[model samples]
Target chain A: MRFGVVVFPGSNCDRDCYHVIKEVMEEPVEYIWHKEKSLSGFDALILPGGFSYGDYLRTGAIARFSPIMPAVMDFAQAGGLVLGICNGFQILLEAGLLPGAMLRNSSLKFICQPVFLKIQRNDTPFSNKFKSMQVVKIPIAHGEGNYYCDPRTLQEMKDNGQILFTYCSADGEETMEYNPNGSLANIAGIMNGKGNVLGMMPHPERYSEDILGGRDGFNIFASMINWLKGVG
Target chain B: MLKANIYVTLKNGVLDPQGEAVKKSLKILDFGQVNQVRIGKFIEVWLESRDQAAAIKELEEMSDKLLANPVIEDYRVEIVEVNQS
Candidate 1:
């Protein structure tokens, strides 16, 4: 599958994401500038991490209005796959493509470390490569990764099975101590109601290779690859 | 010209770690009588229009769509008129 990684000014992880897909995964990938107006030919879009727009005026507030967003929104609305990691997750929430909003880490500190994750669903393209309840280690680096939603939205997401991953122990136990940012319900990742778009705080691309001290994240990219092959 | 000064803050019931830290510092500085302390942002938006009502409406729209994330924040707008020197 062809992947397009959107690069906004101040996005530090665009190159990392591009390398993982192009060199490691052997998949076709291209850098999509923030000003580019089209997502016409890509099978999937990625909003990688970093302090976009220097995290000014809120983390994703300014980046949300970049020229490429309308195209990104159009693509996702048409059932196209969009995966937002880290600050990209912030942008997705700001753009209303995904539910909820991100808040400052409850501890009020920038956290950068590997944490265990419990996969909650495997039917979606983003997690199909993992078995239900599978545990994986991924790194999260951000100062404002806390996720918040109203009671109604939270209930709706729960009922719709939109939640995809939660911070958990190495043995797959979900608990408060494992939550790095005090995200509501230990939520580390979630997809849209339709399950086509996903926003997660953890950085999968950072841990997709053995050189990075972990390889569990490789399946996340593999899942999308297989999903595209099946549908395409 | 009409100026809209907006204050954005986390909504009630949401935890504010930064505010708590500031409150702790204030107490340590001998201000223990303080019952509460909450921190927020103040934004100034200047409008080049004579119609105060229109400016208020527009500022309200701006606050709702971009200035604040309703899920976690609440924003208030006030219109101030500035006199040119």
Candidate 2:
């Protein structure tokens, strides 16, 4: 599968994401500038994490207004697969492609460490490779990853199995202290209504190779490849 | 001309860590009576139309689509007529 990674100003993780997709996954990958308006040729898009627009105003706030966002919105609306990691997730929220908002970390500090995430729903294209309730280790580095939503929407997400992943301990056990950002219900990721768009705070691309850490995250992209193959 | 003031705030039940931090600072400074604080964003938008009704509708759409996250934020928009000499 061909992958297109969006490169915005202040995007620090674009290279890492590109390396993993091109080398580890053995998929053809290319960098797309944030100002470019067309995404017609790419099969999938990845918005990597970083301090986009220097996290000005708010994380992802200014980046949402970039010229490329209109095309990204159109891509996702047309059922194209889009994966947003870390600040990418925040940008998705700011762009209104995903629900909920990110707030400052409850601890009020930039947290950088390997975090465990429990897969809550594996039915979507993003997590179809994992079993429900399976735990995956990935690194999370951000200051505004706390997810907040109203009770009604939260209940709807729970009823619809939309909650994709939750923060957990390294051993896969759920714990309060391991909840790094104080995210409501320990939410680490979510999917859009159609399940084609995914926004997660953890960096799955960073851990896709065994050399960097583990290969658990490799399975996520692999699942996407398999899905594309099945469709094609 | 029309003037609109928008107040955006995190809805009740959602944690406001920034506001919490400021509240903690207030207590640290010996303001013991302060119990709670909530942080919000304010924006003033000026439009060329003098029609209050049209301006309110347009600003509301802007707020819903971009200015606020309805999932966690509540916004109030007030419209007023601007005087021109």
Candidate 3:
């Protein structure tokens, strides 16, 4: 499947995502500038992490008004696969493609380290490669990755099985210490009600190779590609 | 010219680690009377409008759509009619 990585002016991880998907994964991938309005010919889109414009009001606050966002919203509404990582996740929250908002990390520091994530469920297109409750080591680097949502919305997401990943211990046990950002309910990632969009704070592209310290994170891409091959 | 000043802040129940850190530093500096500290953003938008009622409605919509995220933030808009000198 063709993949498009949206690149905002301040986006730093767009190259990382492009490298992994194009060179490492050997998939057709292209970078879509934030001002360009077309998303056609791409089966999936990845909003890689970074500080978009106006990191002032909030992480994704100003980036939502970029010229290309409306097209991205339309793509998502049409049931297209969209993966948002780190700051990308924040953009999705601001765009209303996902629930919740990001707050400063509970420690109030920029954390950059590997954290274990548990696949809460594998029913969606994103995590179908991993077993239920499977653990994967991914790196998270952000200061405002703390996820918060109203109680009612949280409950509704729970009921709809929209939560895709949660911070967990190395042994795959759900614990507080492993929650690097103090995210609500230890959530690390979530899908929209339709399950076509995913927003996760951790950077799977950062650890997509065993040579890079781990390969567990590569399964997410594998799963996405496999799902596309099957559905197409 | 009519200007709208908007303030967006985290909801009361949401955690504000950045604000909390500032509070801790203030305590270390021996600022005793301050019980708590919360941080928020203040923005000003200047637009062409003479009608206060219509301006207020438009500014509120602007804040809701772009200036603030409703899920975790509360925003207030104050309109000021600035006289052209």
Which candidate number has the best TM-score?
A: 1
What order do you get sorting by DockQ, best first?
3, 1, 2
Local accuracy by lDDT, each model: 0.90, 0.88, 0.90
After the best TM-score superposition of candidate 2, give how far the Cα of residue A153 lies from its true spot, in angstroms. 1.7
Q: lDDT at A86 for candidate 1?
A: 91
lDDT of 1 by residue, A80-141 (tens): 89999999999999999988988789889999999999999888899998999899899989
**Chain B TM-score against the true chain B, each candidate:** 0.90, 0.93, 0.91
Model 2 Cα lDDT, one tens digit per residue, B6-51: 9999888778888999999999999999999999999999898877
Residue pairs with clashing backbones, model 3? none
**How badly does each model clash, as a count of residue pairs?**
0, 0, 0
Label model 3 with its docking quality class: high
The i-RMS of candidate 3 is 1.0
How does the DockQ of candidate 3 come out?
A: 0.86
Which 10-residue window in model 1 chain A sums to the lowest lDDT?
A223-232
Ranking by lDDT: 1, 3, 2
DockQ of 2: 0.59
Model 2 agreement with the true structure over A1-232: per-residue lDDT tens digits = 6799999999999999899898888989999999998877888899999999998756888889888999999999998889999999999989988887898899999999988999987777888788888988988999999898777878887887778889998677777788999998899999888888889999998888778868788878987887778741
Residue lDDT tens for model 3, B1-85: 7888888988889888878889999999999777888998899888787777898899899888888888878999888657674
